[model samples]
Target: MLAALIRQAQQAGLSPEPGFAPKELHWLAQLHSGKFTGVLPLREGKKGRQVARCPELSQPEMMALPRVLGQTQAAHFLADSCGVIALLPERAGQEVDAKTQAKHGAYAALLERAAQDLPQLLPVLEVLRNPAELAELRAELAQRGAKATDRLSFAVDGLDLLESELWYDWWRRFRRQVFGQPTTTGTMLDLSSGEVVTPAKTHPKLNKLGVGAMPTGASLIGYDKEAFSSYGLQAGENGAVSEENAAAYRAALEHLLAQAPVLGQMKVAVWFDHRQAEGQALIDAIENPATLTQASETFSWDDWDDTEAIQIVQTPEQQAAVAHTRAQQLLSALRRGETPPTLTAQYFALAISGASGRAMVRDWHTGSLEQLAEAVATWFEDLAITNLSGKRAKRPRFFSLLMNIQRPKPQSTSMDDYLKPIRNLQLPLWRAALDPNAPIPFSAVAKLMEAHKAQVMTGQFSEALSRDGDGEDKSRIYTRMALLKAYHNRKARRQLARGQGGFLMSSSVDPHHPSPAYHCGRLMYLLANVQDAQGSDVNAGVVQRYYGAASSTPALVLGRLTRLSQHHLAKIAREKPGLALTLERDIAAVWSALGHALPKTLSLEEQSLFALGYYQQLADSVSRRQDLAAQRKAAAAQADPHPATSPLAETTQTEQTAQGE
Candidate 1:
């Protein structure tokens, strides 16, 4: 893996040499003939600051920048205030300690030493050595409103000292010599390269290779204790990777980290075979398959330009059309046994997280694109539970699915704290998406079950239209059902692979399912529907009153609810005999499927099945009710071709009839 990353870095045109790294200089110290001229700010007139020319670095230029790790008192040839100013600024409140004085001396000395081989650095070193020139540079910075602490690099006669190849070559050679020399203290070795160093006891820290997105001070490889170092290796000695390969590996990893997609606290980097254009398409397919389905028809590669100033706004109808198109494509593949085009490119993904200044490897996955495609297809196929309209619910992104199961937060909880628990599971779920054989986390299933219970018991159905005309969001419920269905389907798939009898759950409710728990769930939905049939809204409906108990201990709660359902059915019989009779027949069917008695208690998985049955049955019921209302409207239209009735009144009457009004 390390070798592959190093190769990727080299291919990406990153600096393959150990000493070269890019540094963002905020303020350029202008010079003329080795004399301090003025201070030029990089980000002037942009994002609340003023400057000229921006001074952006080209890829090659950035790679060629001289790099070094001067942690504290050790100063770089190009450095901040303490290294450039002999006397600290008063407003800056920086003390000119003995160590700070040493840094300024060291900075000038290094440049002077390198000036011999690189004459371009000579002018910059002359200005730094001159106390008068240094004071003038500081005063000029103050005049320009540049922060005293801003990073400073010299530009002599229109040439950036950092960009000078002579300087870069000289620094490279000096760094190699420094690392190769012996130290009085026990050696610190580079974990990736096994190169020895002094002062610091372990490898250079990670997270600095990229922007601040990577965790600060996180050690990807380190050994601080005696127990961790083995085979007579000294503490912090990395013996596995030698100096020859470490530099290349670190460079490659830094390139990957810079563009790696982040999810909550985890960073996932993907690398694909050279044949592939990029790994982003594969990642999008895994993380959000809906985007990949019918993508070519709905969008063009040219449509997304990072440099484009104006974003094209999509209408809701367009969004719906895209979703519908994806649904049709996925459904067609499943029904007609059509295969997706073969993907030959292979890819690798590494998931890492940081905590307490340590880097943790969450997961690593490597597979052909075909495996990923199939895994995603199977994921959606098994998870495609019906919506309120009884059509396949739109597939959700992996992140959205996880968000659905996120624990409910109190108003006092911060957004980050609320999301922490869910964030911790992102890597595992991502791995599961890329590997069909992997199991969905049981904790996720349990959380979904809890969310379902809360939705039902609180009478706050997601995207549900209740009898009282109260609107509630049902997206959460849909997400829960989708996950539940996939959970059972994957479990069954594994069982079948082992030659054990296991049944896959359907997207819609299956009346003849073998599990009694499924029928109980259906019964629960039917009983609730029976109560809903009553013209008047009840403050406490069957679901709100007993869903928790009915789902878990059906034998105890469902029997009582079943008996009470008769009273609910009887009260609505006079007003809407049709709806009442339909409810009666549905209840009987579920009871027959459930057998003579319900299960005494349901296990966690069985309880999930019960929730699935309830959700699917509710979807079936709502869909039928809507169809019945539509049929009534059509028939009434035929009866009165030009009746003097408002459409609103007609629709309201139709809705009332459907609800047994």
Candidate 2:
């Protein structure tokens, strides 16, 4: 990761070499150095005195300072910056002096040192020479928005002093000469750069830890507690990062924190690097995954000035199809072994979470672009489901897919334990989507079942049968169906090792062969349809009351439902004989496949199959309705002046679809 960050810095034309820092740090260093020259305000008593045109530190140019005890460093505006009394060594919240001094010569020596080092610092020296002059300078600087605690610098010759290479070099030398090596004893291994170098006392704080965190930032390598250490190494030495390498890595991570988008509590950053290092365009494309699908939408043709013209515009559906097409193309390239070294890229992703005043490393992954593209292609393929009209389902956003498995929130403010179970399910599911070979979590189906039961009971079954409804409602169904499919397909593969599984399910219901539970699910759907055919109010329908029981324990619920559905079928036949026969035929086909018997109870795996079967049967019912409606329209259009619309031609349609399908 450090190497990648260093590479990033170099690619952006930034030099974080021995004498130079990264761009932001360089700018900050310049803002605090004293070589800069600009308009300098005089003391309050000297208000009529012309503003000095010399090196001067202003409060607005300052940054947060590092804490250093028992040492004093004076800025260009030494007297102008108040709060120096607290930093003076001779004072400890005591009276200022016996008689003459209000500040008791506070920070006097520190100001004098600056004057002795450079005569250019005369303005500050003059102010410190007189107590009244210092008081006035403080008052004047305060009125101009100067803060006593802020680090101060100046603008010299129309440029920042720290921007001068001479000042950076001088400061580096001064620090080494004055402080010596931080670790007095021995050299240690630098983990980030993989070299032998003196380790730092602590890694620099990750600048701007921006997940709604305190700006004071966090430690990436902390060994403050004894249990956190090993082999007698103390503090950050346990991680053993050299001060230089630590700074570089922190800068890089800070860059990502500023750039990556945060979703929920996960902070994610991604980058694609090439071995030959010539993939700027590829990196740009990889950064915006949506662009992979909707390039024309993001890269507009009308606004484009490229030599090649983009003349065609595609609809959202077409954009989705195009994404799959591109994914497949990438896979085919790998399969054909047509990829060159230039086509190869390395992908890195870091998932971070900030909590407890520290940056937590949640996940770090590296993969080849080819592998990622193939996995993504398979992801979309595995997520595909059959809609109510027996057509392919559109791809769902990852966010919506994860949200479907999550239960509704608690009313109470406290829910930490409740959220852990949900988070456990989410992490593995996310990994499964990325690495196709990774197992779907063992808890996935069970948790989804829990959420499914809640949905059925809460009257949120907006599209329980039709499969496709309106926008967001349809998306939820599609995501649920996709997650179900992925889990089952993976479960089936695992079962193949025991010689207990043979094939995946088709998009529609299979009557030739199926588990008993699946057949039970089909029975449940038919019973719900029976209720609808009789125009019974579905507010307390068969599904609303008994879907959970019927799916898990068929013997207890199926028989009672069958008896109730027969009564419903009798009523439907009286009103619409033709529609009733159609319903009876559908039920009979499923029963015949079940060998005219119901299972006593279902196992856990069987329950999943039951859910899928119910969804499939519901979709088939919707397709049949659509086919019937189309047929009636055709007949009405061709018949002699519509022939007064005979009752036979006008078989009653269930306006009250099952569960509001």
Candidate 3:
């Protein structure tokens, strides 16, 4: 990983030479050598040292400027102290603080020394020397391309020396003549590049990782403890790399982190140095896969331009069409025992967080883009279920699955402290997504089970759609169902690996042939449906009231539920023949599969299957409704070649309904 990162840094032009591995320094050189016009001049506030403004320059030349003079610490001077004068006019207290007085004194001494050597900087020094003339000079500076927030630096000719030349010359001379070489404590093997070089005492820090990790940025690589050192080597020397290499890696990491997608504490980034284009395409493909073979216009590369802003028309039908296309393509490749070249690019992902002041690398996943796409395809297939609103989604993303555990706050990493226990499982879940063989973390599974059990016991039907009139956020039971199914499928694969019996993960309920636990689950849903259909205004149906008991101890719950269901069926048969016949046939088919009796009790795994069975049965209702609608449409078209539409047609509805609905 270190070598790969080093290579990436080299590709990024961060490390210019074997010995010289400067971070922003090399970046600065690139900006200067390139065609930049000017820099934004940020001025300090009148009250404190905060940047008050970085007003624009009128000159077209300045607009092209790239950022060269970036944030720097370590004995640096700014305009408030070094150039012109401090905004003492605005401060109520006239007494100069000791720190400010000392800083200005140093600046004055540096100017005097520079005046003695570099004669061209005389005018700039003259301006810095007078406090009485500072106000007029600052006004002039603003119009001349300096912002109120600018650190007053100089240029000789292009507005005189361009400020770049003045600062660059001074800094270069300072480095060579005064700053000299960085102090090196010991020579050690460079782990990053595999060479002997002087190691840095401490690595650079990782900044801007939301709040509460640490006030100061976290150190990416550190060794403060004696136990961390080897052979009596202190601090960073234990995993020594030259200061140059260290700087390079830190810079690269910082760059990647800046663009990474963050969710709560987790920050995620992906890379594919060798075939970046292909890898990005694969990522997009997995999100919206192509289910069809390539035709002349089977795939459109134009659809994947993230750099360009474009409006998308994403209707449900359009999304479903794309998902179908992607799935078909994936299935063909899997059947053929080959990975598509377009999807075979190498890929790597990193997930990071901050813990106190240290960086916590949550996950690092590496695989072929093909493997990733294939895994994603499987993930989608496993998660196939009707959402709470009775609408089908192609597949839920990793973040969507996470929301089932706990939702992230908008625009920030401020997850509720109460959710910390479950939030910690997010990393393992993300890893499980990338690798099919990897088991979903047991902790995460337990959390889901616990939450489900609680919901079941409370008899609160959570997944009321937005249109349900209650105006509550829909429940995540569908996603919970998907996750449990995926988990058990992986567990089953593990069984297969150990030369034991295993079950295939199903996309829909198979009443004809399902596990005994699945049958128990189906029975529960059936009982609930009968009670709902026969009764009026039942606040919570049988499944909602007793799902916990039925799932855990099926034999004990089923007999009572079965007796109540018989009463429901009898009433339905007396009142509604069409629905009654459908319910009766459905009951017989499922009961036939269950044989004579229900299982006595369910363990964790069986209970999970029970949830799947219930979810699948629920999802099947949507399919059955769609099929009924299609059949009606066919009959109407047959009766009249083109049926006339009217308000009457809108008012009318299907008389026959599915038992579950």
Best candidate according to TM-score: 1
Better by TM-score, candidate 3 or 1: 1
Per-residue alpha-carbon lDDT of candidate 3 for residues 1-661, written as tens digits (9 for 90 to 100): 6666666676665632222212110000011222223333333332222221111111111221112121121112223322223333223334545544444555555555656666665554554466644444544443444322234443333343322334445544543454245555446778988777777666766654543357456776778786886577887777887766766676567656665666545876667665454344444443333323242324333443423322333775554444445445544455456545454346778778888888877788888756776776566665666653345544555655666653323565545564466777777776766777778876667777887766655564434421343232333666677788788788777899998977767667767545889888877776777786632222255656688888889999987988887888888877777667777777777788889678999988788888777767755654565566556656666787765666357224432332223
Question: CA lDDT of each candidate?
Answer: 0.65, 0.56, 0.57
Better candidate number, 1 or 2, judged by TM-score: 1
Candidate 1 C-alpha lDDT tens digits along 1-661: 6656666666666664544444446677788877777877775453222221122221222223333323233455554452344344546555556766766765666666677787777787777777788778767776666654556777889987655554555565665565443354435554444455442334344543332233334656667676765666663343444433444565566567666766656777777664233235546555665555453333322332222222223875554455444443433453445554554566777787666656677788888755655666677777788876768877777767777885456799976777777765676677777777787888888877777778778777622544433222556667778888888888888999999978888888788788998889888877766766543222246678888898889999988887887887888787788778787888888878877778999998899989888878877887877787898889899999996889999998877877762
What ranges in model 2 sit over 4 Å off?
1-167, 177-186, 208-215, 227-232, 275-291, 294-343, 389-394, 410-420, 462-474, 496-502, 506-513, 534-540, 634-661
TM-score for candidate 3, please give it: 0.73
Model 1 poorest 10 in a row by lDDT: 51-60
What is candidate 2's lDDT per residue for 1-661, written digit by digit as tens?
6677656555544334332333221011111133222225323442222221222211211221112112223333232223442222123333333321322243454345444555544444454465665455444444554433333333333444333443443444534553454555448777767777787766555644655344556676676787756577777677777766665666567666666755445566666553212112222232333444332212212432222222333675554454343444454454455542333467776767666557777777778755666566556566778876668776665655656775656686345544566665655655665676666765777777777667765656534543435465565665776777777766666677678975566556667645777888888888777877643323235687888888778988988988888888888887777778877888998888888789888877678778877877777777766665666656655774555656554444323232123
Off by over 4 Å in 3: 15-173, 176-179, 182-186, 208-215, 226-232, 281-338, 341-345, 387-391, 406-416, 456-475, 512-514, 534-539, 633-661
Model 1 residue 194 distance off true place after TM-score fit, in angstroms: 14
- Ranking of all candidate structures by their lDDT, best first: 1, 3, 2
